[model samples]
Target: MRVHVVGTGLIGTSLGLALTRHGDEVTLEDAIPTHAALARDLGAGRLPTAGEEPDPELVVVAAPPDVVARCVLGALVRFPEAAVTDVASVKGTVLAAVRAAGGDTTRYCGSHPMAGRERSGAVAGRHDLFDGRAWVLTPTPDTRPEVTARVAEVARATGAAVREVPPDVHDRAVAAVSHVPQLAASLVAARLEDLDEDAVALAGQGLRDVTRIAASDPHLWTQILAGNARAVRAVLTGLADDLTAVVAALAALEAGDDAPGARGTIARTIAAGNAGQARIPGKHGGASTVYETVRVLVPDEPGQLGRLFADVGEIGANIEEFHLDHGLGQDFGVAEVDVVPAAAAALAEGLAGRGWRIHG
Candidate 1:
């Protein structure tokens, strides 16, 4: 396939790299001169140029939310022979914008690769960015079968799982999964930023985990969340309701009133979270995920982490990952181990029986 990708940032550049490796001819285009030059240097481009006759099998628009539709619509108009797709996170608005601009609907499809990094730009592009991730294609009734197949072929070149969904459905799902989570992480980190030096000194892995996505570029998130405000608001409404319940439960626990009621409320909330979390698909959609965090107190010394790993090894279950929560105030930090849902319960039980203080 001879492919042309516009907006040579992380997504476009990554796709260029993947397509090139799969023996497809790739040409990268970007509004920024440096980005185009960088893509060429990084081998994700044949070089971006304007006013050239666009001849390609597929054209992927990997632009920012604000300009994605305009760019893709322009590409489709100029290259009627090629199938066009976009990797914009927000879909409904982008697709509408293209329609409003009189783009070629039969040859264009809205797509989004459910993968990214805190970083952006052609320089930050990686060849394996979309490997084993889900890439959704939102095609309209007017879309031709050949165009749809070509878009799927491009997705497969990146080693992504191709799924078809309506644009509206994709927008709502991303609002819940991606956009809202970014805001949540940012809020967590922002609250910590307001803390005093001494208070922040007690920061641990749990806080870090919640706030890691906060390191993402604020400008990009601003565009994303604002572009899909209604969907994002719907997701936040649900989150606000859940938070209200959790707060009430904590308040009851603190006041030491209605012990049974508080326990029941907290248990139900935790169970709901666990159940919802288990539905998150694993790598390549191979399995459903259940991450049970088993907290173990580890001494703050050399080889202590290694010993914990060995101890976890003795439990005879696979450890998917481990998190270290540390503090200067305590001599020991908590290690949260992640295992499969089936293995999590037994791993926790077996480790606890061996004198390990494990938490769920």
Candidate 2:
């Protein structure tokens, strides 16, 4: 397929790279010449020459949220014969703009791929970024069925799992799942700005996981949050109310009164959090699976990790997940290998028989 990608940022360049890797012809463009040049140099795609007519089968507008609709409209006008799609995170606002523009709707679809890094720009693009990730397509009532199929084909070509949803539903869902979480991460990370070095040094993996997305490009997030302000504000309001309740409960507990319902309030809040977290889908888009951990002492050497994996493979125990925590100032680390409950005992015993220390 011949494709044209606009905006040369992480999403656009990544799409170009992925499409090109699959033997598709891709042309890249950006508002900034240097950006487009960088994407081209990175083997994402080639830049079209002046007055070169782009007779593409699909045109992907990968602009920021604020200008996504405009980019989509421009692509539609330029490639009147091509199917057009945009990968902006905020769908409702972009759809509203496209509707207001009064452009032909039959060939346009708004899509968003739920994949990204904390970094931005063409230089940060990865061909495999969208692999096995959800790519949402928002097609209005007037969108032609064939046009929608074409957009879905583009998504699938990049190894994404395509999902069809309405613009409003996509906006609200992302506000709760993506936008609000980014804000929460940034808010938590902001509190560490003025903390003492010793206090910061005590941070663990949990803190790293929570604040990881806080490193995203602020300018882009600003535009996205502004575009979806209504939905994001609603989620934030509910979260604020919960925060108020938690704060009040903590204050009451500080006063040494098993005050009316204070303890229960705290417990209920924590329980609710756990319930919500457990509902999140796990690997391969299934409900979270319960796995038991088997801790093994791993010597801090290059081949030690490989040997551990080889040993686990030899035992035929499928590792669901693993984490290695280094023992401070020691020459060994703890490798917590998670497996199905049924495999836990056998894995532990097998490793113990092989001269490996089983912590638990």
Candidate 3:
């Protein structure tokens, strides 16, 4: 398949790299000539030759959310025989804009690959970026079946799992799962900005996990949030209401220990979070299973982590989850290894027998 990727940003360049690696012919383009050259130089794909009118079977418009419609329209016009798709985060806005501009809806399908890094630009492109990730196809009624199939074919070529849904459903789903979480991460990280160095220094892995996506590009996120404003605001309104209740409960508890229903409210809030977290799919998108955690005290030195991993392999315990956390002012870190309930005891015993300290 000959694929033309426009906008040579992170997604576009990454798609080009992935497709090219999959043995498909990929052509690179961007609004900036230098950016396209950079992606090509990184082995993503070749650029168009001078005075050569290149033809592609599929055109991927990986432009930012705000200008995705315009780029998609241009691709549709420029390659009349090609199936067009855009990799913009928001789908409904792009679809609506394309329809309003009288673009070719039948030949167009909007898709969002549910994979990206916090970094932007062609330099951050990775060939394996979409591996095992969800590539959602939001095809409208007018979209031809072959058009959708072509997009899905290339998406799978990059090792992404293709999922089909309506454009409106895609917008609402991402608003909850992706957009709102970004805002939450950014808001939580913002609190650390005004804190004292000592307070910030006391941060743990939990804080780091919650605020990991806070480093996302602000300008790009601004456009995404703005494009999906209605759905995002709806989710945020519910979140705000829940936060209000929590604050009220905290205020009551601050006034007195025996405040009516205050403890119940807080407990319920935490319990609700626990339930939600447990519902998240386990490895390989399998059903969620409760795993028993075996904590080990790891010495702060090189090769300690590698040795621990090798020991776990020798112990025949399959680790389901692993986290390393450092204690404040401590010379050692805690390694939390989660395994099946039946394997946890053996893992703990085996590590202890190997001269490792097993923490409770």
Candidate 4:
């Protein structure tokens, strides 16, 4: 397929690279000439000028939400034969905008991939960005079914799972699952900004984990939040109600209101959270696979980690995922191995019996 990608940022560059790897000729374009040229130099795609004729089977508009509609509509008019898609987080508004602009909505589909980092720009693109992520496509009455399927085809090529959902449904679901989490992360991190060493010294992985997304680009998120204000506002309203209950619960606990009763409720809530967290899909297009993490101290020498994985293969079971965090000035770092819960107990025993340094 000859593909033309607009707005060669993280998502666009990643897609272009993936398509190029698959033997498709991809041309990238950006409002800024430098970015398009840079992406081409980085093996993303060749740059195409705005006024040039586009010979594309697919045109992916990867701009911000506010500009996505215009980009998609423009592509539809310029390359009338091409099927178009936009990687905009908000859907209903963009689709409506295309109609209001008197553009051919039939040739374009709205898509949102449920994956990204706290990063942007072409340099931040990774070929594996969309791997294992959910990509939602929204099509209206005027949209051609084949064009919408073309978007799904590209999504599948990048190892993404495709699901077709209504525009409003996508916005609402993303507000609850994605946008709300980003805001909550920022809110938690914001509370720590003014704290002194005494308070800061108490930081741990829990705080770090909750605040990780706070590192995301605020300017870009500002645009995103503003564009999807209605959906985000609804999510925020629900969160406010939950926060009120939580505040009351904290007060009740402080007032010594039946610790036994309160503890039971808290315990149940924690358990529910555990259950919900476990439902999150595992890495790289896998199922809702759960893993019990067992950290092992491995030497900083070559083949040490390889030998560990070779041992895992010897056990005739699969490893779900693993994380490595190197300790400063140490000969060893911790490799937290994630395996299916059913195999966790036996795997731990096998590695322990083999005299490998295993940690809980």
Candidate 5:
């Protein structure tokens, strides 16, 4: 497959690297000449030499959300015989823009690769970024079947699982799953801005996990949120209502009102969160499974984690999830290892017998 990737940023460069590794002939291009040269240097793909006119079988427009439609349209015009696809996270807006611009709808399909790191640029791109990730194809009624198939084939070649959904459906789904969560994380993280050092020092693994995506590029995310404004606003509106109720309940408690339902309101809110968290897909996109957690005290030193992992492997216990947290002013950390309920007891016993301190 001859694939031409436009905009050699993280997704574009990563796709180029993956496709090139899969033996596809990928060509690199970007608005910034240095970015394209950097991607080519990183073994993503090659750049066109002088007097060379390269025609691609597929043109992947991996531009930012704001310019994705324009890039897709340009690709369709530049390579009339090739199928064109854009990897913008927001699909509905791009599709509408292309349609309004009189682009060839049959040869253009919008796609979203549900994979990214908090980092950006070609330097942060990895060939395996899309491994086992979902790549959604949002095709309109006029999209040629062959065009969709061609894009799916290339996506699968990068080890992504392909799924099809309507553009509006894709936007709504991501608003809840991706966009809203980013906003929530950012909102929560914003509260820590004015905190004193003492208050911030008490941060734990929970805070780290919550604020991880808060490190995302604000410029990029702003474009994404604006592109899918309607869907994001709908989800945020529901979230605002829930937050208002929680705040009112807290205020009732603070005023010593002894409100009969205040506690119940808080309890229900937390319970609802638990239910939603539990419904999240488990490892490898499987149905959620309950696992018992085994907490161990790990010394804060080199090679301790590797030894623990080796011991766990020796015990023949499959780890379903894992988390590590360091205590404030302590020389050790807690390693929370989650395994099947049946394996928890034996794994704990094995680790304890090997001079490991097992925390309850």
Candidate 6:
């Protein structure tokens, strides 16, 4: 398939790279000529020449949310015979804008790949960005069934799982799962900005994990949040209510440990958070299974982590998750390996047999 990707940003360049890796011819374009040329130099795809035929089989608009509708509309009009899609995060807004502009709806489908890093631009693009991630398709009544399926092929080519959903439903779903999380992460990280250097020096993995997404591009996020304001606001309102309750409960409990119902309120709030966290799907999109940790002390040396991973694989025990805890000024750190409860003992025994120190 000949794919013309408009806007050689992270998503656009990643898709082009993925498609090209899968033996598809991809053409790259961007509003900024340098960006498109850089993406081409990075082997994402070739830049289309002047007066060249723009007969792309697929046209992917990867512009920011504010400009996505315009780009998609332009793509649809420029390549009337091609199937058009946008990789914008907000679907309902873009789709509505395109409809309002009187663009050809028959060939346009709104898609969002639920995959990205906190980084942006062509330099941050990876061929495996969409691998094992969900790519949602929002096809309207005017969208042809065959055109929708053709777009699904583009998603599948990047190793993404395809799911068809309504535009409104997609917007609401992402508001809860994506937009709210980014906002919450940013809010939490914002507190550290003015903290004392000594206070911030004691930060651990919990802070790092929670604030990772806070590093995302503010300009891009501003556009996304504004485009889907209604849905994002709804999510924020619910979160604010919960936060207020927690704050009140904590204040009451601090006044008196046995404050009537205050302790229960705090307990219930934490319990609810635990329940929600547990409901998150795990590897391969299956229910998250309870895993036991096998802590091992590893030297802070080159290939130490690699040696540990190789040893775990040798035991045939699949690691579900792993975390490395580095204490300040410590030469040796603890590696907590999480595996199925059944395999935990075997992994520990196997590592111990190989003379590796098992802390737990």
Q: For candidate 2, which ten residues in a row score worst on lDDT?
A: 321-330
lDDT of 3 by residue, 83-169 (tens): 999999999899988999999999999999999987889999999999999999999999999999999999999999999999999
Candidate 5 lDDT tens digits, 284-325: 888999999999999999999999999999999999999998
Model 4 over residues 143-174: C-alpha lDDT tens digits?
89999888888889888899998899988988
User: What CA RMSD would candidate 4 show?
Assistant: 3.3
Q: CA lDDT of each candidate?
A: 0.85, 0.91, 0.94, 0.85, 0.95, 0.92
Q: How many steric overlaps are in each model, in order?
A: 0, 0, 0, 1, 0, 0
Superposed by TM-score, candidate 2 places the C-alpha of residue 78 at a distance from the truth, in angstroms, of 2.3
Query: Which of 5 and 6 is the better model by TM-score?
Result: 5
Mark the regions of model 6 whose C-alpha exceeds 4 Å error after superposition: 255-258
After superposing candidate 2 on the true structure, give the runs of residues whose Cα lies further than 4 Å from its correct spot: 327-329
lDDT tens digits by residue: candidate 2, 250-351: 898899866788888789889999998988886678889888999999988899889888999999999988998876568999999999999999999999
Residue pair clashes in candidate 1: none
Q: Give the per-residue lDDT digits (tens) of candidate 6, residues 199-291.
A: 999999899999988988889899999999999999899889988988998898889877788778778889988999998887777997788
TM-score of each: 0.81, 0.94, 0.95, 0.84, 0.96, 0.93
Query: What would you estimate as the lDDT of candidate 4?
Result: 0.85
Off by over 4 Å in 4: 48-52, 255-275, 283-290, 295-307, 324-335
Candidate achieving higher lDDT, 2 or 3 = 3
What's the CA error at residue 242 for candidate 3, in Å? 1.2
Off by over 4 Å in 3: 255-258
TM-score for predicted model 3 compared with the true structure = 0.95
Q: lDDT tens string, model 1, 236-278?
A: 9988998888788888888886655777777888898888888
- The lDDT of model 1 is 0.85
Selected candidate, larger lDDT, 3 vs 6: 3
Give the Å error, residue 277, model 5.
Answer: 1.2
